[model samples]
Target: MEARLPYDDYPVVFLPPYESPPAWVPPHERLYHPDYNNELTQFLPRTVVLKKPPGAQLGFNIRGGKASQLGIFISKVIPDSDAHRAGLQEGDQVLSVNDVDFQDIEHSKAVEILKTAREITMRVRYFPYNYQRQKERTVH
Candidate 1:
């Protein structure tokens, strides 16, 4: 037999212990408080940025075929790191490092590029799957 459980509609927002949302208000409509926003930093997972000098090389890894099952593969950048400062985001596909094509290079060679280059020029493909849905329109 299929069992049913009760569902309580709770607000996703952070609330103080002494404060409670109004009964008539739905959780989704709650406003974000600046203090609550600051507190959220403590709960969510975060990445560390690797530090780099004025001009430093960047790197990434890719597995599977050139198409499917491809992930960022490697995360060498740290939070607040130099690469992050240069506008490098996580999950970015590293197409080229130092203007060198990475289509068929060995893994070790990729690492060497990051270690030696004074400045990194990576041609990255940001989001492959989700962005492909740009042409579709949906109802909220």
Candidate 2:
């Protein structure tokens, strides 16, 4: 009687272990699928300057303290509106308007600042939805 083994006639080859690129490699230089490179998390907060003609709506809502506690926040952005076209997003914390600090400001006062300006320069911090939800869930 002879002992039998599976695939006794097949040739086998071994390959060296694969190594990933070093962390120091720049993202653009790394070998990655083109479709995988669009990372939304890498986006940084940016200031946007919008020039609205008189009577033109900014197309966003400003809320104070209710959801953001001390910070004035962009509550809503109307689709296809000037604010939307200008890159304003919901949940962004308004840092300043023109040159004035908006921290802890009243909602009406913030609106006043916006309404009085023909050209608005807004500095905002982008608040990701997940981060905001996590913040709201935390008890403090």
Candidate 3:
């Protein structure tokens, strides 16, 4: 038998015994708390600015952003290219391009956005696991 909390219907937010979430904390929002996950720092989001001269390529290929794969992701980072130099890596999820959210964007639309942006400020995070767990959470 499982032990019941004082409020069984409400979920509990459990952090490490030594650490506590600052101020008021909600169970669903614990993920946004910096100290909530030990792996947060390891998968920190980083910003990359890319400028491509006319008739030049940005040096990266993107994949995903379909029903099967819901987020735009970096599939390749060509060596010696600007993307590689900026530390872009394969499997990096493109959170946004020019500040436009790309997480649930369409494949063709994402391509068009990137191609049209002469200089793009991309916010991405490297999630080695591809963040399937988070996707599953959002589905419900």
Q: Which candidate ranks first by TM-score, i.e. highest?
A: 3
lDDT of 1 by residue, 53-80 (tens): 5455443333322233232223334566
Instruction: Report the alpha-carbon TM-score of model 3 versus the true structure.
Output: 0.63
lDDT of 3 by residue, 1-140 (tens): 99876776787787535755467667787777874663566478899999988778989987777554558778778999999999999878899999899988877899998888889899999875664533443331
The local lDDT score (0 to 100) that residue 133 gets in candidate 3 is 34
Clashing pairs in 3: none
TM-score of 1: 0.41
| Cα lDDT computed for each candidate against the true fold | 0.46, 0.74, 0.79
Show the colliding residue pairs in model 1. 48-78, 48-79, 49-78, 49-79, 49-81, 50-78, 50-81
Superposition error at 12 for model 3 (Å): 36
TM-score of each: 0.41, 0.59, 0.63
Point out the higher-scoring one by lDDT: 2 or 3.
3
Instruction: Specify the poorest-scoring 10-residue window by lDDT in model 1.
Output: 131-140
Give candidate 2 regions above 4 Å deviation. Answer: 1-43, 66-68, 129-140
Per-residue lDDT of 137 in model 1: 21
- Please give the range of 10 consecutive residues that has the lowest summed lDDT in model 2: 131-140
